[model samples]
Target: MIYAILTEAQNKQEKQPDMADTVDSSIAVAGLKAAIRVASHGSFLRAAISMGVSQSQLSRRVAGLESRLGQKLFHRHGRGVALTDFGQRIMPRVQSLIAELEAFDALVSDTRAQLSGDVTVGVIPLVSRHLASSLVRRLQSTHPGIRLRMLEAYSGQVEEWLSSGRVDIGVFNRYGGARPVYADPLMRGQVSVIGTPDHPLFRQKDIPFNVLQAIPIAMPARPNSLTDHILGAAANHGISLNIALEAGTSSLIQEAMLASGLLTLSPAGTYVKAISNNQLTARHLCSPSVQQTTWIATSRQHPLTAASRAVEKFIKEILYTSTQ
Candidate 1:
């Protein structure tokens, strides 16, 4: 019965020429809004302040709407304003229009909620520990209905996940090495040599690359590691990199750097908290620092789910805000 009534009303509204004409007038609601608000607030200055617009601009907009309506909507009384009879009559419809807009906004929000679905995110080990945890927490907290699955693995494994349909999105770091097919720069981060505070080179102003390369460093294995890029750079400059430990996991690298006093490079954004906690000392890599571009890419065949999009948006926002 309700559906029939709604359909009849919709058909009737569609047939009415006045309703079609009002469509253009309704489009001007935003401009008419200032007039309605000014009339309600009793002062253009107060309405302007409330709306975050200049008083003159608000007055002009309201006046323009009044001109279009061919009616004096407001009377300028000393120290304040009052709605004219025509303004008073039109206000109920204006209020109705505002309520309808709110309803429309709410409908969109609900539709987005209904469209949201589950997503499995494949994150490289390097960023998973630092960015993924917080990102997951934010997503779960904000959208409790969204189901998220996280696959944490080595960078090469992450690439495989991206090639396969195993994950919707993959986050990896580009260190001037083998480029991923669909990757783009999501954020730029520094990969700096970190060590214990008491390490010999910790207090030094500018440690020569040659002197630094002689020290044993804990680095990630090649094929897709930022450490590999650092090593390649050193080699290009005719410096031999003396790596004491090779690990597939960033956590393992951090543990080894802390326990064995071997320098390991880490993204500054990820490691800043640890640096602040005095767990590690971040020093600038000599001459040319190892800089890396962190990226977010979707699998070629996999379409992104709403949950995945939300998580991606959150990550981009957090990274942008933190970097700023």
Candidate 2:
């Protein structure tokens, strides 16, 4: 009987190391996150800087992840790194998994009586300039527990963030068309020709679209939505634009206008402060007006937490009140 009992104890001891090995060999959440960050940035140094971690530490975490997966995730070169074929194939699934985990965490947090969590919002520069402070103040007064994080970017970047589940909400502009099925229209604003106060265009209440044919205009560079809109409008109206300057941002275009007497076509909201201060003047484009509709959108890929929903509500309220 003593021999039998000793044999059973020995068997249990043998299984302990196996269980320990299983736990140690499993992929860790931290490692997966590190790998994803590195993949997104295409460089370990950049990823580490973005994550507020040391390069060596981030490298080690990704190395461990690669070991567990038994695949080389990145091809290192002098310029940076690129994902291996396997990494490219698996990245989408990994991103989806991480998004699911975040959603689950938000779901668990929502069960508590008080709504509290981080809500990330992406918006175009125009929306950010106009509504960021108001949104922050409203959220602080109403839902103090809900932390608001804002990402100001162009419309295309905001759309990418929304699609990737990187942000809880997105505010962007849709020009000259029906609203996208996924987004809710918040407000509509006229796109106008803007120039310095001394410019000849603002001499009238509104400028005809054909007038732009003779005007030397400053515009955003090609591959931009606004640039595309203006080009398309010019094509439809059978007029040619004399593009005097091509800039990367609205501020640059405005600066060019001030220094060179160049005019730019943009939304009225974009230069509201400048217009009000008499630094710039806007003339509405008429006879086939160009309009931009601002949209509030969310990802269909992820579920919204209660905190996100609360922030969304507050955003809508602020927009509606501001429009009124």
TM-score of each: 0.60, 0.63
User: Taking the candidates one at a time, how many backbone clashes does each contain?
Assistant: 0, 0
Candidate 1, run of 10 with poorest lDDT: 1-10
**Candidate 2 off by > 4 Å:** 1-111
RMSD of candidate 2 to the true fold? Answer: 13.3
Segments in model 1 whose C-alpha atoms lie over 4 Å from true places: 1-116, 177-181
Q: Can you write out model 2's per-residue Cα lDDT over 118-222, one digit (the tens) per residue?
A: 999998767687688998888788778888889976676778888899999999887898556467789999988899989877889999999878689987777
Residue pairs in candidate 1 whose N, alpha carbon or C atoms collide under 3 angstroms: none
Please write out the lDDT profile of model 1 over residues 125-168, one tens digit for every residue.
55666666677688667877777778876666677788787888
Could you tell me which residue pairs clash in candidate 2?
none
Give per-model CA RMSD: 14.2, 13.3
* Displacement of the residue 183 alpha carbon in candidate 2, Å: 1.0
**lDDT (0-100) at residue 233 of candidate 2?**
85
